[model samples]
Target: MARIAVIGAGMGAMAGAARLAVAGHRVVVYERTQTYGGAVRGFERDGFRFDTGPGLLPLPAVWRDLFLKTGREPLESHVEAVQVDPSARHVFADGTEAALPNASRAGVVAALDTALGAGAGQRWGDFLVRARESWDRTRRPLLEEPLWPNWRVLAEREPYPAVPHKRLLRTRRAGTLAEIGAWELRDPRLAALLESHALAYGLDPRTTPASAAVLPYMEHAFGTWYVRGGMRELARAVYERCLARGVEFRFGTEVTAVVEKDGRAAGVELAGGEAAEADFVVAGVAPDVLDRVAGGLAERAAGEVPARRSAASRLTVLLALRGARPEGTAHRTVVHAPDRDAELASVFDGAPGPSARPTVTVLRPDDPALVPDAGHEAVVLSATVPAALGAAADPGSRSGDPAAGAEELITAATRAIPGLRDRLLWHEVRTPADIEAATGAAGGAVPAPALAAAGGRLLHPANGTRTPGLFTVGGWSHPGGGLPHAGMSGALVAGLIVEGPEFRGSQ
Candidate 1:
């Protein structure tokens, strides 16, 4: 059995470590922090718990597969995953509301029709039909398997089938997500609804490829899931699974360098100058962080997809309220920004400042564990913001302070939570700085999932590098970010190490 050293105790790394141990490899996970679960962290105060990272899980099959592969117990046995019916409630800029059902295309169409208009639902339904095509075309290559050696093929081809629209007496097809919203959906609210999915991942819909349509399709088909006791519980389950499989974990022991021997990654160097030799190394970190591993530029294989530097991060505000969560409340609510153009410009293009008015996502899970008592509620408000926050370029706008962003989120949330400020007993704000401290990601920039177009700017570097006996697994590597993608990253790395380069994908 090969000896393996895995860096970071993040979900992806742990997933790999567990599977490697099951494969009879001696695996040791070295984490810089005192705990596991990279950004999938939690905060607790007076019985109130909040997920500091991703609040929900999509395509749970990724984690489920990990559990099934490592042990006889299923994922459901470890933690209860509750699907939020009326998948999400959307509050448009025009004050219209639509509560889409969980995994029910017909229900979503009906709800959109009731709220947006007669043909609104059908338009969205048809768009989803096209989005499914994108998913089918890219799923195996992007999520289920390794990044193809010919990844440029994924970059050059657009999987989304955009309907031809005649403009200025010439026939053209939608290229970017914005074009899809305008030409296909037509209604401004419908456009906003369609764009929200991309924005949630910190992608600028204005420039994101139409292939991103697969995003909503993923959620619509697989459904949104919330793990009981916050998302951190899921992390705990994975960490425990690793331990069960005899994978060792050394927390608070930072790996300072990757030790190379005979031009291969043989082991890792710790903070206090200790070295643990291993047959293989799995790094679960951002590409920028990985470059620092070998004391300089890590070796890159020829034609490997280059790393991307993202500027977007999330501003999360955890609210402790003095009221009980009302019944029949949507588990998640997205309050659309009043000024979508300015908001996108501030986050993706304009100055590094807090958005004047950002699109806010309000999460109110009806879980007793999240509240101090029946009389209390815990709410999380999040918005995409620049990784670097500074004074507003627009002097009159509220731009500099994270407090300003928190205020904007609260104001937008008022539409979702009645008397929000009045009910707010206390609040805590988490910025990208916190993310950097937690994940070692530069500028606390969160990576978006890989898409099929936009010239492959959205794709992450291949998990395999030029260095022998070394591989990468995390949001920053192939298949990109998000909980499901990260889990898949772990599986891919394990597959590569166990089955060699010939392993096409999971059967």
Candidate 2:
């Protein structure tokens, strides 16, 4: 059995370690912090807990498969996987509202039709049919397989089949997501709804490829889910599964460099001059950190890293409310910005000043595990923000007074929750600084999922590196970010290592 050294105890790294250990390899995980979940961490105070990372789980089958393969217990048994009905309630700038049902295209159509008008639902449904085509065409190449050597094909080709629009006797297909929304969906509210999906992932809809329609399609097809406690619990379960498989984890240990022997990865050198030798090494870190540890191996293996997009990191506000979470309230609500063009410009175009309003997603899960008591509610408000802001990089930043972006989030969330300011007991602002501290991403920039266009800006580096015996898994590698993509990265890396270079894809 080969000795494997996994860097960072993030979910992807841990998932890879569990499978490798079960494959009869001696695996040791090195994490810089005492925790194992990376960004999937939780915050608690005075008996109220909040998930500092993603609030909902999309494509839960990834984790379910992990639990089934790693142990006899099903994921449902370990954590209560509850389906969030009426997936999300959207409050548009014009005071129009629509509650989209979970995993039901027909229901979503009906709701949109009822709220936005008769034809709105049909248009969205037609768009989804095309998005499904994109999913089917790209699913195998993008998610199920390691990025092929000829990845440029994936970059050059557009899987989304955009309908040709004939305007003034000229026919053309939509390229960017904005064009799809403006020309195809054709309604301001629908455009906002579509663009919000891209924005949530730290992507600029104006430049992101039309293939991004798959984002909403995946959610509509797979449904939104919630663990009984929080997303952090999912991370806890994966970490425990690794432990059960005989994987050793060393906390508070930072890997300083990747030690190479005869042009192959030998092991990892730690902060205190300790070295753990291994037959293989798996790194689950951001691209920048990997480049630093491996001495520029990232750029050599992955080509030119894409420039940091302005709309990258997230600004989250965790509010402890004084009142109970009322019944019949949708678990998630999106308050759209009044001036979407202005907001998008401020975020993606780096305008001189912040937009007066910002789109905000308000999450109020009914799970009793989050609140101090029935009398109180735990609410989380989040918005996409520009990465690399100088103020967010300061180490001593505090949440005493909300920043401009945070204030916009608070103001937008009030549309979802009436009397929001009065109901708040206290609030905590988690900026890009906090995200950087937890996940080691530069500027705390969250990675977007791999996509087919935009000159390959949305694509991630291949899992198999130019360096022999060295591989990268997680959000920074092939298939890119988001919970499901990260999980798939683990599977792809494990498949390549176990089956050798001839491995084409997961069967």
Candidate topping TM-score: 1
lDDT of 2 by residue, 86-160 (tens): 899999999999999999999999999999999999999999999999999898777889887777788788889
Worst 10 residues of 2 by lDDT: 393-402
Decoy 2 TM-score against native: 0.96
**What local lDDT does model 2 show for residue 163?**
89
Cα deviation at 346, candidate 1, in Å, is: 0.7
Q: List model 1 lDDT by residue over 49-110, tens digit each.
A: 99999999999999999999998789999999999887999999999999999999999999
Give one clash count per candidate, in the order shown: 0, 0
Q: Would you give me the overall lDDT of model 1? A: 0.88
Error of 2 at 32 (Å): 0.6
For all candidates in order, the CA lDDT equals 0.88, 0.85
**Candidate 1: residue pairs that collide:** none
